[model samples]
Target: MRSLLARLSLLLVAALVAGCGADASSAEFNGVRLEQPYGVPDVPLTDTSGASYSLKEDREDALTIVFFGYTHCPDYCPLVMGSLSAAMNHLSEEDRERVNVTFVTTDPARDDEQALRDYLDGYGSEFVGLTGDLERVVELAEPLHIYVADGAELPSGGRDLGGHTTATLAIGEEDEAVALWKQDTSALEYAEDIHALLADD
Candidate 1:
């Protein structure tokens, strides 16, 4: 009887552990609802080359990924963009052609047309960098819930500012945000999510 009781207790503990693991895996963003999703809207903005391109103009049948950060960001910006580039590398050539990635500079003061162009050029030619009028930048960021505030000053006596979140906005074929992947996620996972989205009818 004691042996049977011990076996039952072990089963209960295993079930509890499995339940906890599932909860952690599916954890949602704090204070951010998954229900009322907001995507990057179609707006006119100047790319790094000073050429104007609408969000609608850049989008295609596949998923579009958008990141918001400044050139001056020391760590997070580069890391996130690197992960995105890695994710793109994992894609097949046909899939690569479908996906479009845009880097939007929240710190327009330091990231003017020329600066923005130079920064993203190192990453990949396919990666487009965009910066423009401050008011227009805010208008584009508000819907995605991206928060940009002025940061500390640099040693060069220049005022340096940065954005808060490391969120990637994933837009579907309809030009609406279908999913938001956070910083903790891996490039492989992001690529998988994009593949799933593309496969869907």
Candidate 2:
């Protein structure tokens, strides 16, 4: 688990290090910019509401920020979600309405529909939760540079999590990935970045 966290840490630092000059004219937050745009895969999955939906079908007007994590994560998952919750609150009512935060679990075996609903409600009802084929989930996240690491379950029952990346991917109005926010990034910075995206298009 520590190794997984370390991997995410290094990737984020690398991203922050790269593309620093690319968005200097307008970027309000320090996040890695992909060399090429990545579109959300049309992978089929079930939302918390049990309806059929795909990331590709989410709103085009809204800046969709997707996090690939599990509900059972002892620390990182909740922390990132909390940051998003606070960040969402900071947006103006108009901008907030244009932001959609979706949580897609890397551990579909455990994050059942009821569990997802309960877990996401802690952040906000507006947050969407999706749980389905782990492989499909991986396919959806791989291009964005997010992958899951499933550690062995402890004797007590909960499994250790391992994921290659721990960044919230912000999809732009063009439906292409624009930024990657590390898990520990401040809520205020997230709010600012979201606003910046809205201002751009």
Candidate 3:
């Protein structure tokens, strides 16, 4: 009886270990899957200060979040930025330092150098606002799967425009977009995702 009990106990222990390993491999939070391998493309952009920035160069040993929206976006732009700010507030100083948040305006005409700078100033200094030549902007937007339609006919004097998608991308250290968080997602959720990426070895 003792020998049989010992064998059963070992089997139970092995089963528990296997289950724990599976759970860890399938780690997820708030319905967001935490395991995926992807990357962001290398694109050249001009910052609000007219300085050139390449996605490959700007990427360091941290996670970078990129959002494509114009300054004139009445609802989405500010809301997303605000949520991002809130999410940053929840992170530790080290994690915050390991994260780069960029706001790229699709409307280069109105969101000129100074205009882009001023708009991002309302957020945080760490937040970078990038806008460059229209042609370059279109080229950069293509690979990201973002489509911006010229909406010069809406409220507020027909300055309204829409994009193909309202999504923010999370780029890992290798310049690859690891995950995409939609505009409707909460800041806390965004923070969690960033934390997960940071924790990944």
Candidate 4:
């Protein structure tokens, strides 16, 4: 897992650097600009409100930020969520309204609707949480190239809820992923990229 993360981090860094000098036709972003945009996953999952949510059909805003991680994650998940929460705080009310964030749990056994809701409320009420059968979750993540795997028991007796890709997908107005943000991206960067995307729209 450590090695996998290292490789993924390197790839993310390369992508970020590659996007630094985007052409006038493209919106300059702090995130890695995808050469080929990814369409929103067509799968439906159970939201915190126990309602079925489809990323492809039920997006509430023009831009949707989607991430897949479990609340039990020891490092990456909390850090990313905190950064995103801070980023949202930095946005103007209008820009905030143009963006929506959704967190889909890769560890479904422990992340029921209420649990997902409780965990996400700490980040932002507007942040949506979703969970379902692990197989279904994998189905939702596969198309995006978001990794998910079975966990292993930790040395401390706590279980590590497997491994998952830490990159966040920024789905644009056309239901396609226009950019990717690495796990360690700063809140200020997130806000800047979001504002730029909104401006382009």
Highest lDDT scorer = 4
Candidate 3 residues lying further than 4 Å off, grouped into runs, are: 1-27, 30-39, 149-163
Model 2 Cα lDDT, one tens digit per residue, 46-102: 898898777787554568888887887888888999999999999999998888899
Give each model a TM-score: 0.76, 0.79, 0.76, 0.80
lDDT tens digits by residue: candidate 1, 1-201: 999999999999999999999786655322122465576566778887788866666655477788887788887788878878888888888788888789888777778888877788777777888887666766777777765434454453333434446688877666677677776567787777666666663
What's the lDDT of the predicted structure labeled candidate 3? 0.75
Model 3 Cα lDDT, one tens digit per residue, 46-154:
8877888877686564888888888888888888899888999988999998897888877787888898888888888778888876667656666765554444433
lDDT scores in order: 0.72, 0.79, 0.75, 0.84
**What range of 10 consecutive residues in model 2 has the weakest lDDT sum?**
151-160
How many residue pairs clash in each candidate at the backbone level?
1, 1, 5, 0
**What lDDT score goes with residue 104 in model 2?**
88
Evaluated against the true structure, the overall lDDT of model 2 is 0.79
Q: In candidate 3, which residue pairs clash?
A: 39-176, 39-177, 40-175, 40-176, 40-177
Off by over 4 Å in 1: 1-34, 149-163
Candidate 2 vs 3: which has more lDDT: 2
lDDT of 4 by residue, 64-93 (tens): 888888888889899999999999999999
Superposed on all Cα atoms, model 2 deviates from the true structure by an RMSD in Å of 11.2
Regions of candidate 4 where Cα sits further than 4 Å from its true position: 1-28, 150-164
